[model samples]
Target: MPADLIFHHYANSPFSEKIRLIFGYKQLAWKSVIVPNILPKPDVLALTGGYRKTPVLQIGADVYCDTALICDVLEHLRPEPTLYPPHLKGVCRIFAQWADNTLFWAAMGYNFQPKGAAQVFAHAPPDAAKLFAEDRKSMMAQLVRLRPGDATSAYRSYLRRIANMVDEHDYLFGAQPCVADFAACHSIWFTQTQVPVMADILNATPSVGEWLQRMMSLGHGTMAQFDSAGAIAAAKAAEPQPPGANYLVDSAFQDDHGIPLGARVAVGGESFGPEPTEGTLIAATRTHYTLLREDDRTGAVHVHFPRLGYTLRKVEAG
Candidate 1:
């Protein structure tokens, strides 16, 4: 039997919601391991080395970081209800990428305006907002955010564009909810779910609001609660799947980077999340980079990352 899909994410994470909605769309069974929204994510680091993104997907000993790769993995596992439709695969992925980054940041910029931020943390401890701000400040590797005014304008314009797309159909792409729908929805979902005070901005696009309801009706699929200790145990009990056809791009080494296989390297986000995962570079496929990570708790593990929006570097021995 194939290993279970063990997902590590928090309830309030916007990216995690994107993956969760994908699970609902695919109706796939998965195990949920909620990680800390802030820091001290020792369990997460054990699985990802240093990739500190929320919503890490683990299957047996293989740890997949980034929701982009997670979406591809899920689509590979469940191909019937596809995220990448054959007729519009490239366009779907491109739009999804834009939604994940540009739209998400814009939504956050507007969502965190004073009143909205206050409303979001109204129920949490007083330090919650300050700690969160500090944590995110550290995680952000570069200053790519827009000013509040620019963010509002961009978010409004993007909402109208989405409204135009959904005006004709139930989803962003077509009759079905493709990746673009989930990608676009999560940003707006954050605004609606986390900061309703700022969500008034969404009132202008009633079509988008209607589309969100249709998307939410799908619901997250069957999930069993799995704790961090249990996840660590699962990792320790399994062996990393050997490199095979599924791990290869064209069944050969695609050496765009001068560094070859077997060298120690670090793979990390190019524009964000400065933390890098250091390990023996096992595979550098056109689409991803795989590293063999040895943990005392998890033993030999394969950590995979997408090539886009990330960088690969040689890790020098000290």
Candidate 2:
């Protein structure tokens, strides 16, 4: 059976945008489950067992967290129109990593300034902004964040660096749009599309603006909405395919926490919105890990965790 895809995400999420674009790029049918932008996502938490980031990919009993892993899963599902070209594979990986880590944070910091924040909360209640601010503050561990001034300065520098890349070719790395280009462009898209009041920063780089149009033209493909309950039902109704017989190079299991297989454990990012989920570590491949966790609201589910920026510790000895 062609794997059923459940994208657990919200519309305004930039990382979610990246996956949406990929879905369109591959012309794959996906079920959209609009997760809350903030916390207390009971449905999602139940499925994840703790890792609560946006844009998780669910296929039957397998759940894939992190856009990077989702990208790979999508690639494996549909190889044509490859995101990572054979010749540019190394550069593509490097660029995608940089885009996800650096460009994404910088653009978000710039986009969430006082004006942008006010615009975002314009339709919201008085306490809405306060609650959001408090929630984000708690996530940051009460660290004083970069002021609007610092954010603008940093964002402008990052934009200029991207423009330098475009000065050579239409795309960041080369002629074709690689993983890096799409990953980097989504954050900028969020700035320009979601928070246009502060989008003048893009005017400094005409090339990037042109590139943004190209990326947007790719357009999000055939997306049909489905509720959380429906998604869980779909998952429970299906079974995940075993990862095909492919041997991983230098594949050796690292037993760090003495958490044996089938032990109840949760894996997720360390800091900033640390929502961990409980699951069983059934498969730990070189590229990814699989968690078998069931959600009462949704039924038995399989959640996938990327081995990067995630911690795997036992869920007590119970």
Candidate 3:
């Protein structure tokens, strides 16, 4: 039987939209659990230890933190619509990473300018914008954020580059959409769907806009409403898949940090959203880290973080 995919995310979250679109392209059936846009994400913390990034994917007792890993897991589960197509495999991943980080931040910096911010928070409570700003500030204090004007310039150039690619092909790559397309489209999706007031930035590259429509048409796959309570229950009742249960298991532990498999460790993103998820390191594969963390509400759930953008630290014996 296929494991139930429980997705925790808010509707307006751009990162979440990327995963949702991938779900559509792959024709996945998943359970949706809406999470708060702001912090005090009690439900999220209970499952992930402390990593509170949007759009956490939970399958049974396994919680995948980042979208990159989530995409890999989904690909492993359902390989038909392969995320990393062979011809475009290496380039697709590199492009996806750039789009997810550089393009995403640049688009966001442009999207959340004063006018865009006002429009984005217009429907929310008066203090929503301020709170959201402050919250993001605290979470990303160590990282250098783009300035609105600078971001606008960068975003425009990126759009033109994207247009060049899509002008020749339907997607970022060829006819079929790859992970790069999903990664690139989310911020543009945000601009069009959530902050149309600022979407004019997309006009310079009409081809990109055309590409966006094509990507949007994929639509989120089959979905059912689920509550965080039910998700917690599912985690509690299920045991984590054995180490390397799927091909996700690496042949041998690759130890650059000198941290053993059984050691207590904290895994977190390298820059943005550095909040660590502390637990016993059950698996430290070349591509990811698996943390076995226990909670009163959720029992033991394996929290996985991709190695590319994340850091791992062993907790010294106390």
Candidate 4:
């Protein structure tokens, strides 16, 4: 039997919500492991090394970082209600990438205005806002963020484009939801659900709002709470699953960075949450790079990251 799906994420994470909705769409039961919203993410770092991002998916001894890779894993596991439609796979993937990054940033920029930020931290501890800001600021060091006024304008324009897409079909591409739908929904979902005060921005695009309601109705599938310690123990006890011969047979070593397989390397995001994860390069496919790393708590594991929007480097010898 396949090992249980273990997800590490928090409630307010928009990316996590994307996976959760995918679970609902697939009707898959999963183990939910909630981690701290802000650092220090000791438990998460235990598995990801330094990739302190929310919503890391753990299957047996394999750890998948980045929602893009997680979505691929989920689709591979259950191909019934496909995330990538056969005919529109390329288009769906391109649209999803844009939604995950471009749309997400614009939505967040608009959502976290002074008014929305106050509403978000209203019920939290006094220092919650400050700590959250500092944590995000550290992750976003050297990256440019859109200002509220500019974000509002861009977000509105994006919404109108989305409105045009969904004006005819029920989803962005067609009658059924695809990877692009889930990716786009999460960002807008945050504004509508987490920051209702500023949600009026979505009101202008009635079509987008209606589409969001449909996506929201899917709800998160069956979920059971799983603690960090238990998750770590599970990983420690299981052996890493070997990739199928077919899995890597056709996937030749596409060396873009000149880093050979078995070399020590560090992979990380190009912009936000730039903590580098160091490990031995195991697989370098056209789309992603996989690393084999060991942790005292989790033993041997394979951490996967998408090639795009991320940087790869050789870890210098000490």
Candidate 5:
């Protein structure tokens, strides 16, 4: 039987939209657990410990963080309509990483300008904007954000580059949509769907606008609502199914941090949402790391994070 795929995410999360689009592309049904858009995500923290980022993929007793790793999990689950087409595998990965990090940051910096934030919080409570600002400030403590004017200039240039990429093919890299296409689409999607006033930035690139329509048409696949309590209970009752021997393994133990398996460690993002999750290091592969952790509410679980864009360190005991 197929494993139960539970997605913990909020509707407005751009990364969540990327995964949702992937789900649509794969025609996979999944359980949706909507999380809060702000801090004090207690329920979410109970599962992730300290990795408080939105859009975490929970499978039985295994929790996968980061869209890159989650994409690999989804691909492993349903191999057809592969996200990483064999021919463009490495190129697609590199492009997707750029889109997810650099392009996404530029688009977001532009989208959250004073004018766009005003539009976003227009319907919300007066303090909603302040709260969001404080929350994001804390999450991105030391990370440098581009100025609105600079971000706007960069965003436009990036959109033009994307237009060039999709000018000939229906999607980036080929006729069929790949990881790069999905990674690039979410940032644009956020601007169009959530902040239409700012979406004028996309107008200059007509090809990109047309491609966005094609990407949007994929639609989210069948989904069922799931409550946090139910998800917690499911995790409590399930045993983690970490990658088996058949799974990809690094030839050498590739130890750069001097951390070893079975040691207590913490893994987290280097910039935004830098909260670290501490656990017993279980598996450290070439592409990702796995942590074996247990909670009273969720029982034993294995949390996974991609090696890229994350920091791993030994937890110093008091």
Candidate 6:
């Protein structure tokens, strides 16, 4: 059976935009379920247990959280348009990691300042913008956010570096687009496409603008809109599948958090978005971990999160 692919995301989400581009690049038919920009994502919470990040990919009973993991799932389903090429795999992975972490956040911090923030929230209600700001503030917690001036500087520098990369070749890695290109382009795309008033930073690097045009050409292919309600119903109707037995990364004892398997825990991503996901640790592999939990709406869905940014803590077992 061809596994069902459901994308739980909103349009304004830059990370979600990255996956949408991937879906279009691969020409994969998927059900688009628009999720909320901020918290109280009950439907997404239903599928993910508690990993309330945007762009959760639902494949059968498996719920993949984070755009990084979603990329892996998409690659598994469609290998034709490979995001990570064999020769450029290492460099692509490094560049992608840098782009997703550093570039993406800097761009967002800069793009969501007063000027760009107004452009984004122009259509949204006053309360809507306030709620979004409050929600993001809660998620950020102790993390230090860059000042608008600093953020703008960092973003401009990052854009120049990206332009330098494109100056050598058509894409970040080479002639064809790679994971790094998509990851980097999406953030820049958000500034240029979503918040054009603040897009003047791209003027210093016209090469980045030309590159973005090419990226835009790879349009988000035919996505039939699917309701979040229907997606929750689909997940509710299904049975949870066994977790993948194979380990995807190297297992090294990095942290002192000696949490055992099957222990109830809450894992929160360090920066950007710090929402905590609570569940039973089903699989603590080398790279990622799988959590099994019951949701009132969706019954059960195995949610996955990358180990890098997330901090795992033991929750009181009932």
TM-score of each: 0.97, 0.90, 0.98, 0.97, 0.96, 0.93
* Candidate 1 local lDDT, 1-318, one digit each (tens): 268899999998999999999999899999999999888899999998999989899998999999998998888788869999999999999999999899998988888989988998899998999999999898785758888999999999999999999999989888998998999999999999888878899999999999999999989998999999999999899988766634333335789879989999998888768789999998887788889999988898899898898889998889
Candidate 2 lDDT at 234 equals 72
In candidate 5, what are the lDDT values of residues 121-160, reduced to their tens digit? 9999989999988888888996888988899899999999
Better structure of 1 and 2 per lDDT: 1
lDDT of each: 0.89, 0.76, 0.91, 0.89, 0.89, 0.81
Which prediction has the highest TM-score against the true structure?
Answer: 3
Clashes in each model (backbone N, CA, C under 3 Å)? Answer: 0, 7, 0, 0, 0, 0
Q: For candidate 6, lDDT tens digit of each residue in 1-318?
A: 246688888988988889989988888888899889888887787777666778788876778778777777677667778998999988897888899988877898899988898999899887988998888887778678788889888998999888898999888888999888888988998999889999888999999999988988888867888998888888788776665521123334334478777788887787856677888887776667777888788887777787777778899857
User: Against the correct fold, how does model 4 do in TM-score?
Assistant: 0.97
Q: Best by lDDT, which number?
A: 3
Q: Residue by residue across 108-194, what tens digits does model 4's lDDT show?
A: 999999999999999999999999999999899957999889999999999999999999999999999999999999999999999
**Cα miss at 281, model 5 (Å)?**
0.1
Question: Candidate 3 versus the native: TM-score?
Answer: 0.98
Clashing pairs in 4: none
The root-mean-square deviation over C-alpha atoms between each candidate and the true structure, in angstroms, is 1.3, 2.7, 1.0, 1.6, 1.6, 2.4
What is the alpha-carbon RMSD of candidate 5 to the true structure?
A: 1.6
Cα deviation at 316, candidate 6, in Å, is 3.0
Model 6 earns a TM-score of 0.93
